[model samples]
Each structure stands twice: as structure tokens, then as C-alpha cells.
Target chain A: MNILIIGAAGMIGSKLTNRLIADGNLGGKAIDKVILVDVVEPTAPADAPFATETMAADLSSPGVAATLVEKRADVIFHLAAIVSGEAEADFEKGYRINLDGTRFLFDAIQAADGYVPRVVFTSSIAVFGAPFPDAIPDEFHHTPLTSYGTQKAIGELILSDYTRRGFMDGIGIRLPTICVRPGKPNKAASGFFSSIIREPLAGQEVVLPVSEDVRHWHASPRSAINFLIHAATIDGEKVGTRRNLTMPGLSVTVGEQIEALRRVAGDNVVARIRREPDPVIMKIVEGWPRNFAPVRAPALGFRSETDFEQIIRAHIEDELGGTFVA
Target chain B: MNILIIGAAGMIGSKLTNRLIADGNLGGKAIDKVILVDVVEPTAPADAPFATETMAADLSSPGVAATLVEKRADVIFHLAAIVSGEAEADFEKGYRINLDGTRFLFDAIQAADGYVPRVVFTSSIAVFGAPFPDAIPDEFHHTPLTSYGTQKAIGELILSDYTRRGFMDGIGIRLPTICVRPGKPNKAASGFFSSIIREPLAGQEVVLPVSEDVRHWHASPRSAINFLIHAATIDGEKVGTRRNLTMPGLSVTVGEQIEALRRVAGDNVVARIRREPDPVIMKIVEGWPRNFAPVRAPALGFRSETDFEQIIRAHIEDELGGTFVA
Candidate 1:
């Protein structure tokens, strides 16, 4: 099977690429050729079992999407998106990239003369709005409060409809915030979730902008990659018409995350996280969904770590050579 | 207020137009001019109190939408759409007209140099797919099973996002199946719902394709127009971020509708509804929502009649000039 990963330069995307290469197969079909695309030229793996090509392209620009999908990949992982803060700040750019760019890709595939492929799209929990129940149910409405979430929700609708029309086999996974994200912190409002943990473990100081009581749903980068793999290979018929699903995630408060960090790396690592109340971040975090009753994804064989301790353990083993700075 | 009614040739659009003309004002603002647009030129209301123009235009065609909103009408009622059955049979046309057409209009509004008008978008209950609770709540997720529903759901999302971004003052009202729709029987799967009530009172026979046990949500055409008007004039601040509301509707079984028909026009009119099971139509109806607990729309002052009898009486009074073929 030929594989294509859009936004392959990003954290989760790169990890997925490495995993696929290591496994050398997806859904029992050997991945013979891989195409990795992003806004900038992606860094290709130095050594790999299969053919690899890195292409730089902006999908939001008219006609670019058609060229990207000319290969007619057997499987496509669409993970490219404008983050929440950027989408909110730059409205036009946000819609252009998130909404129009996605539509262009879907339209390109639909117009590709019967070339239907399994499309695994990365949707975000931002598709939900606040004033939510303690454990938001699957049936809760998608009344997105932000432009980014609205675009993702719209993408979910399009994916479902196109799949129903047999134009593509599409599965959209609403991912939880990835904890202990590798590398430098970006501008995303949720970036603090990762930085608080990653920075402390790296023997650096990081600020906890919000209170420990602020609970959020999370899965490790590894679990998110696994979700993409499972979504790509799953029997789509079992998903029926509802192709988009809220992935099962561990719901933990900031205090619990700190506790988990203390357990894994001890008091020294825990002491690295400092309290600094940032009202802007706090206001943003307050509106986010706290937890979800994601029953379907688990039923479909998409699994994540049961707790934050395991998430931290995985991060240490994967990123720090089985050891944190402590 | 300068009012623009897209799909002005259709039943609800035309009635809404006449209602506006008759009232001579909308939400306390005196009506001055009305622009009516459709695929064909709408018949001008000869004695209309306001300045009126009926223009033939297809909104899906490029530049047409731009011209329609060029005047920047103070209140825009976007009621145009391809019906469900037609959209199902012609997928490309559905996306083109129902989806792209709406987007084109919205983009036009966005591009009109800060001309943010009150956009009253007419969405449908079809946006809510089947397998609903006995009384579907306002917060129920939009998992549309049909292309038509998908299109409407997408429109609602766009409206909400656009409004949130301050591009427009938009309110999307999800109307129930319009009972006793004044027209010849159309190809829509839901058309029979109205025909049984409409044709029977007109001394004509109509088929009851589904069983008596089949329940559906409904509002009179008057109520639908009122919902639109309320959506157009209501304090948008009250709606907040969730701009789309499932309008209040009466939940009635086919047996109840028949009983109302019998009560109003006697056994003869009830007998005019011939039972002929259409497996295809039955299959379509089976996937529709049966009831709703639309709390928000009513709280926001969008009201509907209490019973099906009032619905029949409304049709007789409005369409048949105060008389049915009793």
C-alpha cells in the first residue's frame, strides 16, 4: 500500500511516519512507497525500507491540492491545520487554510475519476463548545465556539457525506490534546499542557498558567499516532454513517498531571513547574471541554494509556532514552 | 428595512414576502423595499405596500450572489435550496446549489465592505438525523444521514462562525417539516406529509405512503415565516455563539394528523387519504426525527401552534380563502 502523510513535518505526523516505516506495513498491506507533504519541505528519514519522497506544497492555494493527490495514494493521513490561537487571531487565514484548504483537498479527491482512498483526518476537541456537562456525551451537539473548531466540524460533515456517497473511505478522529509534546512550545493555547510536563522533565522551568483543578482530556503523542493507524486500517463499514468520533482519552486535572510527574520523576522534577496565573490563557482554558464519554472509538479498537503516569513513562522512554534529566 | 428573499418563487418564501408586505414593517422597522429572487421570476404581489422587484437568478452561478447582495439589503432571508429527494438523486447538483450556493452568498456578504446584514438562513429539521430520543433535545448532535441535511448542517455551522467573527449578524432557524404546504405534490420524500393534509382538504386524493404510527415534527407555514422573522429581528446577543436553533414544532403522529383532518373537513376528507405503502418513501421517512424538545427557540420568542387542528385550520384560512372543499 502506498501512503501519504500531509503535515508530515509536525510532531505527531513525524512520529507516525517513523512508526509506519518501522512496521513496514499497515492493515497487513506492506507500505511500499511513502509521500510526505507539508507547507515546507519535510525532512525525510535518512534510512528507510520503502521509497520516500518529501514534497513542499500549500494546499490552501488554489489548484495545489490536485497536484498533491495526483499520486492517488491508497491511504492518506490529513493532519494539517491552523492552531486555535492563530485561527482566532487571523480569521481570513484560518478559514483559508482550515476550511477552504480541506474542501479543496476533498474536492480534488472527489474529482479524481473514481480514485477512492481511505482518508484519516485529524479533527480536534475544539469542535466542542463550553458550558458542557461533567462528562460530555457522544450525542452532545457541535456548537463550536471558535473558527478552528467550526472548520473541523464542517470537515467532519463533509467527510461523512463524501464517504456515504462512496467518493472516499474517510475516518475523522477528534484527537485529545497531546501531552508531553516533543520539541519547543508553539503558540497554541493548549501548548502549556505539554510544556508544563516536557520542560520540567528536561530540567527546565515552565509555568502552569491555570489552576491545577482545570481538568482536560489528553493522550500521548504515541497514542495519537496509534489512533491514526487504527483509523486508517479499521473496517469503515462498522463505523456506519458516523465516521467522525471523539477518541477515548484520559481525563485528568492539572494537579493530577503534576502528581503523575512527581511519581515518575520525583519531587525535583515536580518542583520545576512554577505557578504563574495568566488571565488570557486561563480564560481560554476555562471554555474548553473537561471530559468526554467517548464510547465508540474504544469499541473500534482505538486505545490510549489508562492514566497520566503511563503517558509520562512513554514520553521518557521515547524522547529521553529511557531517562529524564533527574 | 430593505428585505431580500431568495427562493421567492417557493411557498414559504412567497408567503414570507406577502407577510412582510402586509405588515409593512419588520420588528418595528417600517418596510421600504423588497427584492425577490429565484431561478424563475417570482410573481409580484400587485397590491404590495412596499417597493418590490422580482429577479430571476440562480445563486449557484458565479457573480449572481454578488449582484443579489450588492444592494446590501438590511434583512436577507436565504430560503433557497434543492429539496431532499432531488439532492439525493443528484449529488453534484446538491453540493453545487445547496452548499456552494449558500457559501457564495455568505462570501459575498463578507466581501461587501463591512456590510454585515441580518441574515436569516432557513435550515431544516433534516439536519437532525434519525435514531433520536422520543423528544430530541436542543443539544442533540447534527449527524445528518442525507445530503440535504448535511448541506443544511454545514450552512448552520458557517452562519454561526461568520456571526462569531462579526462578519454578519446571522441567525439560522431549523424549521420543521412544513405541513399543508401550498402547492402541487413535489418529488420530496417529505412531500406526502403535506399532500395528505393539503390535497384532501382541496377535494383531491393523496397517498399516505407511511404507516399511521410514523410520527414527525411539524410547524405551520405561518409559524415557519414567524420563525424566520423572529430570527431576523431578535436580539442576536441573546443567541450568543450558538446561532442555530431548532425552531419550536408540534410533534404529531400520522393518526393524529388524520384525526385533525377528519375533525375539520369530516370523514370524507379523511377518506381521501389513501393508504398505499411506498417501500422507498417508508425507508426515507424511517430515518427522520420523530420529535424535538426545542427549548431555546421558544425561550428566544419563536412560537408554534399547539395542535395539528390549528395547523389544518390555518391552511384552510390562508390558502383556500377561509374555506376548504367541506
Candidate 2:
């Protein structure tokens, strides 16, 4: 089986690629080849038994999607997107890449004629918006508050439509904010969730934007990758007409996260977190959903970490040899 | 005040135009100019007091949106769309006109260099999908089962984002299926609702596609026009961050509708209806929401006809001079 991973250089994309390579096949089929495409060239695995190819090209560019699909991938994981903050900040670029880019890819797959690949799309919980009752159920409206969320919601719609039309078999997984994302901090408002722990563990002071009681939903990077794999392997018939499902994640307040930090790394690491109270970020966070009742996804066999401590532990094991330097 | 109506040649669009022209203003603001645009020439009212300009151009085409906004419309009623059945039948055309067309108009308003106009977008309850409860609430999730619904949901998203960014003040009114729609019948799955009564009232036999027990949400054409106008004048602050609202509608089962027909035109007209069960239309209608709890829209001053008999009477009075030949 041949697999293609778009946005293969990014966090979840890279991890999924590595896992697929290590496993050698998805669902017992031997992997013949893997094509990795992204705007930035992906790091090729040093030791891979399967044939691997890498390409750095912007999928949003006209004809790029068709050209990429020319190789006829059996299964495609479209993980590319401009992050929420950047997409919101740059309106034209965001829609062009997120909306137009996804459509182009789907259309390209359809244009491939005889080939119908299983498509796994990574959607986001940003698709849900405010005035939400404490814990949002599986069937909350997709009234997105941001351009990023809107784009994700549209992507899910297009994916479902194309699948319904028999162009491709598609599954859209609406993932939560991935906590403790490894590597340098990014510009996303939710970055603080990671920075509070990541920066502090790296012996640096971090700012907490909102009050300790501010709550949000999250999953670890590992869980996100797991979702992608599961979505790719699962039977599309099981999803039926409802092609998108909100992935499960832990719901924790910033205060509880701080407490988790204290329990895991003691008072020193927790004390390194400073409260500056940036109202702009706080306001953005305010409109976001704090939790989701991912009943559909859980019933479909998708799983997530139960709490924040487990999230921190996963971060340590995956990124830092299960040790905190601070 | 200048008013712009996109898709002015369409069925509801023409009716709305006539109403607006007949009234001369909405909310007491005299409409000085009526810019009527569509892919086809609109039938302009001969005695329209306002200076009427007709432009037969597709809004989805490049620069069309900016050109429309350049005329400095104080209020825009965007009613353009490919019908549900047509859109579902043609994927590319659907996305291009519905999704990209809406996006272009939104971006055009934003690109107007700070000219913010009141944009009243006509959305649809088709945004909701299957496994729906008896009555869908305003908080229901957007799991659009069809491409048409998906496009509308995406349009709603863009509308909200543009509103939030202050590019243009947008209000998306999710209209229920307008029953007793005047004029020639089309291929919409819900057309039978109108056809059964419309044909029989004309002393013609009408075929019912599904069982009489199938219930669906509906509004009158007058009510639909009312929604557009109300959406134009209502205070955006009252709508807050969520720009889309489900318009108030009367939910009636097919049997109830036929009963109303019987009450209005006697059993003779109702007896002309023949029921040959169609699983195809039945399956499609099965996913549709039977009713809606439009609590938010009503509190904000939006209203609808209270009874189904009133709806039938309104149709007769407005379309058939309060009498049916049959």
C-alpha cells in the first residue's frame, strides 16, 4: 500500500509519518512507498525499509494538488494548514491555503479518474464556538468565532460532500488543542498552554495570559497522531453520512494545569509561571469551548489522555526522556 | 438608503424585490436606489420609485463583488444560490457559486477600505443533518448531509468572520423551507409540499413522494422576505458574536399540511392528492429537522406566522386571490 502525507514536516504530520514508517504498513498491508509533501522539506527517516520520497511544494498553488495526486496514492493524509493565529492575522492567505488548498486537493483526487483513495483530514475543535454550555455535546453547532475555525468547518463540509459523491472515502477528525507540543513556542493563543510548561521546564519564565480558572480542552501530540492513524485505518462505512467526529480530549482549567505542573515538577517549576493577564488573549480564549462530549469519536474507538498530568507525562516521555531539567 | 439585492431574478428574489419596491423602504428608511443584480436580467417593477439599476452578471465572477460594493450599497440582501437539487447534482458549480461566490462578496466588502454595510445573507435550515431530535434548537450542530447544506454552513462561517473583523456587518438568517412557493415547480425534494396543493388547487392531480407522516420545517414566502428585511435592520449588537440565527418557522407534518389544504379548499382538493411512497425522497426527508426552537430570533424581534392554516390562507390570498378553482 502506498501512502501520501501532506504537511509532513509539521508536528502531527511528522509524528504520523514516523509511526507509519516504523510500523511498515497500515492494517497489515505492507507499505510499498510513502510520499511526504509539505511547504517545507520534511526530514527523511534515516532508516526506513519502505521506499520514501519527499517534496517541498505549496499545495495551495494552482495545479500543485493535481500534480501531487498524479502518483495515485492509495491513502492520503492531508495535514497541512496555516495555524489559527496566522490564519486569523492574514485573512487572504489563510483562506487561500486552508480553504482553496483543501478543495484543490480534493478536486485533484477526483480528477485522478479510476483511483479512489481513503482520505484522512485533520479538522479542529475551533469549529465550535461560544455561548456554549459548560461541556459541549457531540452535536453542537459549527458557529466558529474565527477565520481559522471557519476554514476547518468548511474543509469538513467539502470532505463530506466529495466522499458522498464517491470521489473519495474521507474521514474528518476534529482534534482538540494539542497540549505540550514539542519544540519552540508558536504564535497561537493556545500556545500558552504549552509554553507555561515547556518554557518553564526549559528553565525559562513563561507568562500566563488568563486567570487560573480559565479552562480549555486539550490532547497531547501523541493522541493527535493516534487520531490520524485511527481515522486512516477505520472503515469509512462505520462513519456513514456523518463523516466528521470531534476527537476526545482532557478538559482542564489553567489553575488545574498549574496544579498538575506542581504535582509533576514540584513548586519550583510551577512558580516559574507568571501571571500577566493579557486581556486580548483572554478575550479570544473566552469565546472558545472549554470542553467537548466526544461521544461519537469515543464510540468509534478513538481515545485521548484522561487528564493534564498524563498529558505532561506523555510530553516528558516523548520530548525529554521522561525528565524535567528545571 | 441604498439597497442591493443579489440574485434579483430568482423566485424569492423577485418577490422580495416587488415587496421592497412596493413598500419603498424598510424600517422607515426610504430606499433611494435599488441595485438589482443576477446572472439573468431581473424583471424590474415598472413603477418603482427608487432608481433601479439592473446588472446581469454573475457575482461569483472576478471583480463582480467589488464592483457591486463600489456602488456603495447601504444594505445588501444576498439571495443568490444554486438550488439544493441542482447544487447536489453539480459539485464544482455548487462550490464555485455558493462557497466561493459568498467568499468573494465578503472579501469585497472587507477590501472596500473600511466601508461597512449591513449584509443580510439568506441561509438555510439545510445546515442541519440527520439523527435530529423532534425539534432542532438554535444550538444544534451543523452536520450538513448534502452539498447544498454544506455550502450554506460555510457561507454562514464566512459571514460571521467578516462581521467579527468589522469588514461588514453580516446577519445570516437560516430560512426554513418556504411552503407554497409560487410559480412553476422545480426538482427540490421539498417541492412536493408545494406541488400537492398547487397542482390540486389548479384542478390537476399531484403526486406525494413520501408518507403523509413525514414532518418538516417551513415558512411562507412573505415570512422569508420578512426575515431578510428584519435581518437588514436589527441591531448587530443584539446578535452579538454569533451572526447566524434560525428564523422562526411553523413545523407541520405532510398530513397536517394536507389537512390544512382540506380545511381551506375542502376535501375535494385534498382527495386529488395521490401517495405513491418513494424511498429515495423519504430517505432524504428522514434526515431533515421537523421543527425549530427559534427562541433567540424571536427575542430579537423576528416573527413568523403562528399557524399552518394562516400559511395556506396567505398562499391563497397572495397567489390565488383567496380562492382555488378546484
Candidate 3:
């Protein structure tokens, strides 16, 4: 089986790539070839069992998607997008890279008529805006508040339409905020969700931007990668017309996350978290959905952590090699 | 105030144009100019109190929208789109005119460097797909079953995004089916909705293609025209970020429609209706919305007929000079 991973240079992309290589197969079929691509050149896996190619290409630019589609990878994972904070900051760049870029890829696939492939697109919970219900259902309408959310919602719409038209077999999964990220803090509005747990566990001080009561949906990086794999291998017929799905997630407040952190590590680790209210990020995050009643994903066999503790545990095991600063 | 109506030759567009001329004002402001456009050359009103210009322009064509936007009409009504059946029949034409054409107009306005006009976009209930509730709420997610619906939904998304970016002051109203339509039977799947009432009242035979229980939401052409004017005049501030809204309409079944027709045009006129079930058209109409809880539009002061009789009455008064063939 041949596989193609777009946006293969990102953390989740790299993790997914390594997982596929380690397994040496996908959906019980042996992985014979893999192509990794992003705006920046992706690194080829070392000592690989299959022929792997990595290249840098801007999807928004014409002809780039055509080249990728011409390769005719059996299963395509389109995870490339401008991040939320950056997309909102730069409107033109956001629309070009996220909206137009994704369109280019879909159109290129259509251009190669009769070469239908399984396309797994990464959408986000940002598609849901504020004034949300306590637990948003699977069929909640997308009223995006930010440019990033708008672009992602549009991506979902386009992918679903293309799939319906038989241009491709597509599934768009709206991911929850990933917690305990294994890296330095970024400028994302959701960064605090990860940083509070990740930094403290690593014996470093972290700032809490929002209040303790501020809640949001989350999953471990492991679940996210698993969602991608599951999406690629599932029976597309079962998804029916509603291809874009709100993924299952653990909805918890900052207090619960701290409690989970305190339980996992010692009190000393919990003390590393410093509360510093950021009204800007708080206001932005306030409009985000705190939870979802994602019946579709769960019924489709995609699972995630039930509690915040398991999420932090998964992060420790996956990102920290089963160890932390303690 | 200057006004621009794209697709001015269409039924709703023509009604809106004549209404604007009759009133000679919009939101209490004197109407001085009206630019009407469609795929075919629109007919300019003779001896109008305002300067009326009529022209034909394919908006999807490059530079067409730019010219219209450069003129900087203070209130622009974008009502151009292929019907649902036509869009389903012709995919490229649907996307070209509905999606790309709408985007062109928004982009053109943006390109003019901050010429933000009040853009009243006419959306439709077709945006909602099948397996719907008895009464679709304002928050219902759009999973359009047809290409025309998909294009309209996409147009709503684009206009909302553009509005958010300050490119234009926009409001999209999802109009219900206009019942008691004044014209010969067209090939539209929903044409029977109007034809059943119109043809019978005009001493012509009309086929009832579906069952008596098939329910749908509807309004009069006058109500549709009022919707456009209200969308133009309503304070955009009230709409906030979610600019697209489902318009109010009378929710009645085909049986109720026949009852209203019998009441209006007498039993003799209603006898002209012939029952002939069409599986194809029935399948299409089956996916339509039965009713709507358009909380937003009502809150914004947009109103429609409370009962189907009022709808039929409006058609007779407006189209038949206050009398029917009976």
C-alpha cells in the first residue's frame, strides 16, 4: 500500500509517520511506499523498510498540488493548515494557505479523474463559535468567530462536497485541543492548556493565561494521531453524507487540569504553575467550545482519554519517553 | 441612496426592483439610482422617478464584479443563483455562478480599498439537507443535499467571512419557497409548489407530483421582496458575527395548500389539480424543510405570512389584479 502525508513535518505528522513506519503497514496492508510533504522539506525516516520520499512544496501555489496528486498515493492525509493564532493575525496568509491551498489539492485530485483515494482532512473545533450549548452535539452548526475557524469550516465543506461528487473518498475530523504538548510553549491561544501541564511536569515554571474555571475540550497527541489513522482506514460508506465529524474529547477546566497535574506529579510540580490572567487570550478562548457530544466519532470507533489524568499520563509516556523532569 | 441588484431579471429580483421603485425610498432614504443586472439584459423601468440602469453581466467572469464594485452602490442586493434543480444538473455552472461569482463580488469590494457597502445576500432553505426535524431551528447545521444548496451555503460562509474582515457590511437571508408563484410551470422540482395553486386559479390544469402529506415552508413573492429590503435596512450590528439567517414562512402540507386554494378560488378552480406522482421530483422534494424556527430573522424585524391563505391572497392581489379566473 502506498501512503501520502501532507504537512508531514509538523509534530503530529512526524509522529504519525514514525508510527506507520514502526508498524510497517496500514489497515492490514504492507506499506510499500510513502511520500511526505510540507511547505518545508520533511525528513525521511531512517532505516525504512519502504521507499520514502520527502519534499517541500507550497500547496497554495498553482501546480504544487498537481505534482502531488499525479503521484496517486492510495491514501492521502491532508493535515496542512496555518495555525489559529497566526491565521487570525494574518488574514491574507490565512485564507491563501488554509482555504485556497486546500482547494488546490482537492481540485488537483479531481483533475486526475478516476484516481479516487481516501482523503483524511484535519479540521478543528475552532469551527464552533461562542454561545455554545453546554455539550455541543455532532450536528451543531459551525459559526466560526476567527479567520482560522472560518477557513477550517470551509475546508470541511469543500472536502465533503468533493467526496460526495466522487472526486475522492474523504473524512474530515474536527480535532480537540491537544494537551501536554511535548515542546516549548508557542503563541497559540490554546497553548496554556498544554503549557500548564507540560512545563510544570518538566520542572519549569509556566504562566496561566486564563482563569481556573476556564474550560476547553482536549485529547492527547496520541489520540490525535490515532484519530488520523482510524480516519484513513475506516469504511467511508459508514460516514454517509455527514463526513465532517466532531471528535470525542475530555472537557476539563484549568482547575481540573491542575488537579490532574498535582496527582500525577508532586505538589512541587503543581506549584510551578503561575496564574497570570491574559484578557486577550482569555476573550478569544472564551468564544471557543468547551465540550462536545460527538456521537458520530465515538460510534465510528475513535476513542480518547476520559479524564485529564490519563491525558497527562499519555503525554508523559509518549512525549517524555515514559519519564519526566521528576 | 444608490442601489444595485444582481440577477435583477429573476422573479424575486424583479419583484424587489419594482417594490423599490414603488416605495421610492429604502429605510426612509430617497432612492435616486438603481442598477439592475442579470445573465440577460434586465429591463429598465420606464419613466422611473430614479435613474435606472440595466445591463447583462456574467459575474463569474473576471473584471465584471470589479466594475460593479467600483461604481460603489451604497446598498447592493446579490440575488443571482441558478435554481436547485439546474445546479444539480450542471455542477460546473452551479459553482461558477453561485460560488465563484459571489466570491468575485466580495473580493472586488475588498479590492476597492475599504468601500464597504451594505450587501444583502439572498440565501435559501435548500442549505438544510434531509433527515431534518419537523421544525428546523436557526442553529441547525447545513448539510445541503444538492449542488445549488452547497453553493448557496458556501456563499453564506464567504460573505460572513468577508464581513468579519470588514470588507463589506453583509446579511444573508435564507428565503423559504415562494408559494403561488406567477408564471408558467418551470422544470424546478419545487415548481409544483406554486403551480398547484397558480395554474388552478388561472383556469389551467396543474399536476400534483407528490403526496398530500409532503410539507414545506413557504412565503409570498411580496414577502420575499420585503425580506430583501429588510435585510438591506436592518442594522448589521444586530446580526453580529453569524450573518446568515433562515427567513420566516408558513409551514403547511400539500393537503393544506389545496384547502387554501379551494377556499380562495372555489371548488371549481381547485378541481383543475390532477394527481400524478413523480418518483424523481418526489425524491427531491422529500428532502426539503417542512418548517423553520427562524428566531434571528424575526428578531431582526423581517416578517412573512402567518398562513398559506395569506400567501395565496397576496399572489391573487399582486399578480391577478385582485381577481382569479373564477
Q: TM-score winner among the candidates?
A: 3
- Show the colliding residue pairs in model 2: A140-B141
Instruction: Give the winner by lDDT.
Output: 1
Q: By TM-score, highest first, what's the ranking?
A: 3, 1, 2
Q: Which lDDT tens digits does candidate 2 get at residues A186-289?
A: 77778899999888887788989889999889999999988988998898888888899999999999999999988999898888889999989988888888
lDDT tens digits by residue: candidate 1, B1-326:
79999999998898898889788999999988999999999998998888998899999999999999897899999999999888989989999999999999998998888799999999988888767898999999999988999999999999998898888999999999888788899877888889999998889999999999899999999998889888889998898889999999999999999999999889988988899999999987898999999899999999998999999999999889988886
Every candidate's lDDT: 0.91, 0.89, 0.89
- For candidate 1, write residues A1-326 as lDDT tens digits: 89999989888889999999889999889888999999998998987789999999888999998997898899999999878888989888998999888989999999899899999999989999988999988889999999899999999999998898888999999999998789997767788899988999999999889999999999999999999999999998899888999999999999999999999999999899999999998998999999999998899899998999999998998998998888
| lDDT of model 3, residue A326 | 65
Local accuracy of candidate 3 as per-residue lDDT tens digits, A1-326: 89999999998899899889888899888999999999999988896788999989999999999999988999999989989878988878998999899989998998897899999999999888879999999778888888888888888887888888898999999999877677889888788999999998888999998999998899999899889999999999898988899889999999999998888887999999998999999987888899898898999999999999999899888878787776
Rank order (by lDDT, best first):
1, 3, 2
- What value does the lDDT take at residue A71 in candidate 2? 78
Q: Give each model a TM-score.
A: 0.98, 0.96, 0.98
CAPRI class of candidate 3: medium
> Individual DockQ of the candidates?
0.88, 0.78, 0.70
**RMSD for each model, in Å, please?**
1.3, 1.9, 1.1
Q: In model 3, how large is the Cα lDDT of residue B313?
A: 91
Which runs in model 1 stand beyond 4 Å of their true positions?
none
